[model samples]
Structures are given as C-alpha cells and as structure tokens.
Target: MIVITTPTGQIGQQVLERIVDSGKSVRVIARDPSRLPQRVRDRVEVFQGSHDDMDVVSKAFAGAESVLWLVPPNPQSGNSTEYYLNFTRPACQAIQSLGVKRVVGVSSLGRGFGRNAGILTAAFEMDALIESTGVSYRSLRMPYFMENMFHDLESIKSHGTFYMPTAGDQVLPLCATRDIASTAAALLLDESWSGQDSVPVVSPDSLTPNEMAHVLSEVLERPIRFQQVSIAEYKATLSRFGSEAWVKDYMDMVIAQNEGIYDDDLQKVQPSDTSFRTWCEEVFKPAVLAP
Candidate 1:
C-alpha cells in the first residue's frame, strides 16, 4: 500500500487520483476525512489525523510500502523550522519503524543553500530531518509554483495590473503544480532509485514578469501591465492584506530570486506539457472569469 500525506491539497489530490486510478492500494492522511472528495474517499483508505501526531502517523504507515510526504506551510508558528521539524521528526521516526522502502518528499529548489535563501531555510532543515531516517528517499526540489501566481488574478482582473517584487526582466524558473504532482507520483510509484536524491522539477521555459504579463494580456484579450514593486513596497502591500508572516517570507523569497539563489545547476524534469501561455489560457483566465 502507498500512503499520502495532505492528500486533499492541490497537488496531493492529483497525486492521489493518479495513484488510485492505477488500482493501487492507497492510504491518505488528513486531519478530517470528510474534507476529501467523495470519489477519493471511496477509492482509498483515509487515516484521520495530522502529521505531527506520532501515533497517528505510525498507524498510517502500517503495511505501507511507499510514502509521499509533504510539509504544509505554517504561517502562525513562532519558528518555522521548529514547526517543520515537529512534523518531520515524527514522520521520519514512523517511517523507520514501519520500514517503508521508498519516500518521495516535496521540498523547495533552494533548500540546499540554507539561510541564504530565507524561509526556504526551514525547508532545508526538514529535508535534513527526513533524509536522516535512512529510507530510500527522493526529494522533489520544485521551482516557483505557477499556482502561486493565482494570488494576483483578482488584482489583475480589477485593475489590469500585475504586481511583483521580481525585476521585470529577470527570467526565473517556474513550474506548474500539475507537473510537480505528476513527477512526484512517478517517483512514488517506481521504487527503483535509492538514497538521498534531489530532483529538480522545473519548466522547460523561463519568463520574466513582463513576459508573463504579456502572455496574460494576450490570454485575457485585454491590456495588462507588469508593475515591479520595491521590497519595502511589497512588504507594505502584504501587510495591508493582514498577512505579516507571509509578507516577510515572500519578501525574503523575492530577494532570494533576485540574487539567483533559487537557480540550481541540476537537470530539470519536465512534465504536463503545459506552457505558461497554456496555463494562463486554461487555468488563470477561467478562474478570473468565474464569479
């Protein structure tokens, strides 16, 4: 049996669907099983609990051969590292105890760089804790998620302006969550490769914020301008939205992006065959037009 953590999330849902469609015995961990879709809940066994609970995680890992692990973001924690470690420690211990043969973990691209990458530092620490479990593990080091860009869809629809802290001309790596989910599912299903592999799942194309704006403009059939905001301005803007911790983390991530810290020398794994323009047309445009 294969076990999945946070199986109701954007990427997790896709992973769970792929696994279930393959006729595999699947188990999913969630704090509330009722939150899962009726289709998924019917196909897989649901373990109702959080990752931080050792007894719950241990029970979920029982009889599972492979696991897909994800560390959910904790914005309310006083220390992000501690919050991640709290989840990782128990999961790792459980994995060891249960003798799960393979694990595919979702981690960020810049984790290896440590504190030089700001909040990603916490992700790096989680990677360390998980790897120490001595299981055959593959860490999916993903680039900037295209899903993250959805945050600005409302602002773009309202004002025809997309704002970012990135330099308007800097081409940075970006990947769709669908691609990450597919790649992660493949890794979890295969069980061929072994210990401590960091895989970079990046898009084949890289684009600047201005270029992305042009694509959005074309997709929406309207004029859209890219407005690059200073770090301070970005922080102030996020603060106004009542997300102080997110503001700090996002500002730091922007700085890391500007410094090219997220630029890893690893080969990329391309999946989904979805381009930025296609994503804008199919996903973003539809969402903007909805309601």
Candidate 2:
C-alpha cells in the first residue's frame, strides 16, 4: 500500500492523481476530509487528521509500503524551521516503527549554502531527519516553481509587468510542480530504489526573470516586463499578512536565493521539459483570463 500526506495540496494532489490512476492501493492523511476534492475522497482510504500528529501518521502508515511525504505551507507559522520539523519528527518515529519500505519526499535544492536560508533551511533539515530513519528514501529537491509566475497575473493584465527581488538579468532555475509530482509518483510506485538519495528536479533553461517576462509577453501577445522590487519592499508586502517571525522567514529565503544557495544543484538530474513559456501558455493564461 502507498500512503500520501497533504493529499489535497498542489504537489501532493498531483502525485495522488498519478498514483491513483496506476490502480495501486493508496491511503492519505489529511486535516479536513471536506477540503479534499470529491474525486480524491472516492479513491483513497482517508486517515483524517494533521500529519504532525503522531497518532495520525501511525494509523496512516499501517500496512503501507511507500509514502509520498510533503509539508504543506503554513502561512501563519511563526518559525519556518520548527514548522517543518514538527511534522517530520513524528513521521520519522512512525517510519522507524512501522517498517515502511520506501518514501518519496518533496524538498528543496541547496545543502551547504542553504544554511540560515529561512523556510528552505527547514526543508533541508526535514530531509536529514527522515534520512536518519534508515528507510529507503528519495528527496525530490526542486527549485522555484514555474507556477510562481501566476502571482503576476493581475499586474500583467493591468500594467503588463511582473515583479521580484531578483535582478532582472539574474537567471535562475525553475521547475513545474507537475514534474516534481511525476518524479515522486514514479519512485513511490516502483519500489526498486534503495537507501537515501537526493534527486534534483531542475529546469533545463536558465531563464532570468526578465527573460521570463519576455516569454509571457510572447505567449500572451502582450507587452510585459520584469520589475525588480527591493528586498525591503518584498518584506513589507509579506509583513501585511504575516507576523514578524513569518516575515523574517521569507526575508532570509530571498537573501539565500540571491546568494545562489541552490545554483549548484539547479541543473542536475531530470532537467524538466516544462518550460516557462509552456507553463505560461497553458497554466498562467487560463488563470489570468479566468473571470
């Protein structure tokens, strides 16, 4: 049996879709059964509760062979590192006790350079905790999501521009969440790989935010450009909705990216076929054009 955590989430749901289609026995742990899409509820056995709860994970892993593990974002979280570990520690305990054979976990790129990297730092630490369990594990380390571009839909429609703290000329790696899910699904379903290994899911192209603007412009047939925002401005924007603790987490994350935390692993293993332009045309356009 294969188990999935965060079953209704962006990456997790995609993994669920891929695995459920394979006709495998699947189970999921969720906080709210109602939040789950109706189709998903029909297919998998549901273990309702937070994955952070040891009881929840223990029950979910019962008789399970593999699990697609992920920590969903907590915008209200005060500390990024603690937030990730809170869910991970229990999972490590459960895996060790349950004798589950394999796990595919979603994590980020950057090992040495990611220290003090805020939210990403937490993700890396979670990887270590799970690896320590001696379970067969694959850490699907990823870069920026191509879907992050969707945050610009409104501005692109109104002013023909997208914004970020990165220098317009600084090219960064990008990946589609769908590709991450595909990697996880393959690993979770096969059960062939053993031991602990980190798999980098990086993009083939080094597309700068400005180049991404051009791609969006070309695909949407509109004038668009990248607006470089100040890191201070980035903080101020996030501060409106998040506590100071939460704001600091994102602030450090941006600084780490600017300092090239994941650059080394950005182009290794399984360069994604999904391009910025393709994602723009397919995913971004539909959402921006939606009423």
Question: What is the lDDT of every predicted structure here?
Answer: 0.81, 0.87
**Residues 1-291, model 1: lDDT tens digits:** 899998988888889878888878899999888888898899898888897799988999998889998887655554566667887898888999889888998888876454555567667788888888888888888777788777788888899987877889998778888888888889878857887888877776778988988888899999999998888887876677644655566567678878776665434454446688888888888998998
**Candidate 2 — which residues are off by over 4 angstroms?**
none
For residue 175, give model 1's deviation from the true position in Å. 0.3
In model 1, what is the error at residue 202, expressed in angstroms?
A: 0.7
Candidate 2 yields a Cα-based lDDT of 0.87
Candidate 2 lDDT at 28 equals 91
For residues 207-232, what per-residue lDDT tens digits would candidate 2 score against the true structure? 88888888888888878889999998
Q: Per-residue lDDT for 268 in model 2?
A: 55
**TM-score, one value per model:** 0.93, 0.97
Best by TM-score: 2
| Angstrom error at residue 262, model 2 | 1.5
Q: lDDT (0-100) at residue 235 of candidate 2?
A: 86
